[model samples]
Target: MDFFEVINNRKTTNGPFDPRPISKEHQRILMESASRAPSHFNSQPWRFILIEDAKKRAAIADLAGRSMEKLIADGLFFERYRPYFRFSEKELEERGDGIHFDQLPGPLKPFAKQIMSPTGVEIMRRMGVPKMLGRDNRDLVAGSPLIMGVMLDKAEYIPGKLSGFYSIFGMGAAMENIWLTTHALGMGIQFISTPMEIPENWQQMIALLGVPDNLELMAVYRLGYVKEAQRRPSIDWSSRHRKRLSQYVFRDSCDTPESDDL
Candidate 1:
């Protein structure tokens, strides 16, 4: 695939992926691509664990599901991310950022406006939405063929330090390389992120991965080959919209915004 095309087409796969295991060649390419990312003074602080074991994947999935349920049941998920939920086309166009809920199920349509409110959360709970969504999340992760854990060296990833910021920047670049490579290789990847939202769940993941003292687990991702026909989850949103250049970019001076037409 073309370089720019690969970038343009790259997206977080929200649905389940094909069950086939990733080919060895493609895995090697992903790791090598990540390694090629530039680091601060060549301090390669990033580490990765490629998990293909079914049992381990199941365990991770369980934690992920339970975390999702807890977050939703306690109304933390909606409360914390309320700003990023757009319920209308006009809202999405005006913001030009954040996920747009353009594919909600019929039952959720009437409550779209108040979905982030406490009352809306209570309604969802009464409807058993948390368990339903939790099951969907679990199935998605459990069916994935590969689970990758990203880590950083503790020496370089210290909090409130210059090296810490640099390490995170380098890790982002490395993950971007891997993410784009997955798109070019006919595979899909999404972050297993809910577990990180809960402290206990995050610690469990670290233990399950057997992370060493020297390394800190930064993120987890599930990956597999994509299917032609993707079945959307019970509830879904799309983040295809992006901020225009004029909205986010600046010229030489901060006061001058770049022209989007250019």
Candidate 2:
């Protein structure tokens, strides 16, 4: 793929990774592209722990499940993130952001809408739906051939300072490099955020991964082959998946239109 083609074609491939191990050459290229991302003060604060062991992957997946179960048991899982979840097709249409049901499997559509209502969630809890969902998450994460733990080393970044912002910006650039490179290699990458959203879960994940105290895990993601062409959610695709360049870009001064060069 060419430069812009790679950028435009990249999409999250969480649902249908084919469970194939990435090639040695591709893995090398993956890390190289990540390292090449620009960093503040040339201080590459990011560190990665790549997991290929099946048993370890299973354990990590199970830990994620358990962490989720704990959250559900505490009766706060949905309560915490419910506001952030855009449930119905109506909500997606209005906001044009957040997870849409089209991004989920066809089977999960009704549940996605139902869970937003307090009564619906209470009913699911009584029926052990969250437990089942957590169990399913194990299979979900374990199915991936490569599990990447993206971390930031505190010592390498200037914490509590403007440099810290630069470090994070650099880390996002690195992840994008990884995403684009993975797509170019005919593979897919899906960011996993269940752990990062909850503090207890995030700590559990850190311990399960054996990451030392010196490094803070910023995010986790899975990588593998896609079984088929990934579907672009209609709500997102309707607008070509981004804001109009005019909405964010501008001309020479403040309120002017962008020039033709854009």
Candidate 3:
């Protein structure tokens, strides 16, 4: 398959992966592919620590499991829904006499109201927290065969004072390479950003990976082989209208319209 096709077909796999050990040749190919990833100023800021040790994988899985348990026990899992619905700042201010909602940012004022809204509370109740907690537990218990820690160097320079963006961008490229290589090798891969525990745990994981203090752990990826291919959620690409090239294109002069074909 073409490289572009591989990218288009790439999907997250969380189901069982094949237990066969990855061969040296296959590992070399995957590492080569990752090395080909683009980086700013030829500075490859992304470092991948492959975890093949079963004991270490189990320990990481345990941390993830405990984190999820803590979140459930503390009722922090419901906080994930806060971004879906919120109230307007004006409504928040109107509801109270001394509650200066205007003092808050226009975008955030509504979030406070959302937490207090009856509908939001109802949605939270209907989220079936127990079921989600159970699923989280299961996911952690079935640890992946190949676990990788992605770290980013803080010294990498990005365009426009966005050093973090450059690091993440490099890591993103490496991640795509890893995914495609895994697929071609008849393996499975899944990204688990949610498994990131508290700041202290994050620090510990980074330390275990032997990354520099200036660098931070960006993500954790799991790889394995499975008979079942995870199906991607169908996207409604046609539902939204796209802008024509002419809408944003310009010629030599600022006001001159450029030919769409050109």
Q: Which pairs clash in model 2? A: none
TM-score head-to-head 1 vs 2, winner: 1
What count of clashes does model 2 give? 0
Ranked candidates, highest lDDT first:
1, 2, 3
- Identify the superior model by lDDT, candidate 1 or candidate 2: 1
How many residue pairs clash (N, CA or C atoms closer than 3 angstroms) in each of the candidate models, in the order given? 0, 0, 5
Tens digit per residue, CA lDDT, model 1, 142-232: 9999999999999999989999999999999999999999999999999999999999999999999999999999999999999998876
| Global Cα RMSD, each model | 1.1, 4.0, 10.2
Question: Which digits, one per residue and each the tens of the lDDT, describe model 2 over residues 78-121?
Answer: 67766655656676655555554344345545676665567756
Please, what are the lDDT tens digits per residue for candidate 3 over residues 68-96?
A: 55554444543653342223444333332
Error of 2 at 159 (Å): 3.8
Stretch of 10 with least lDDT, candidate 2: 233-242
For model 3 the local lDDT of residue 92 reads 36
Backbone clash tally (model 1) = 0
lDDT of 3: 0.60
Estimate the TM-score for candidate 3.
0.63
Best-matching candidate per TM-score? 1
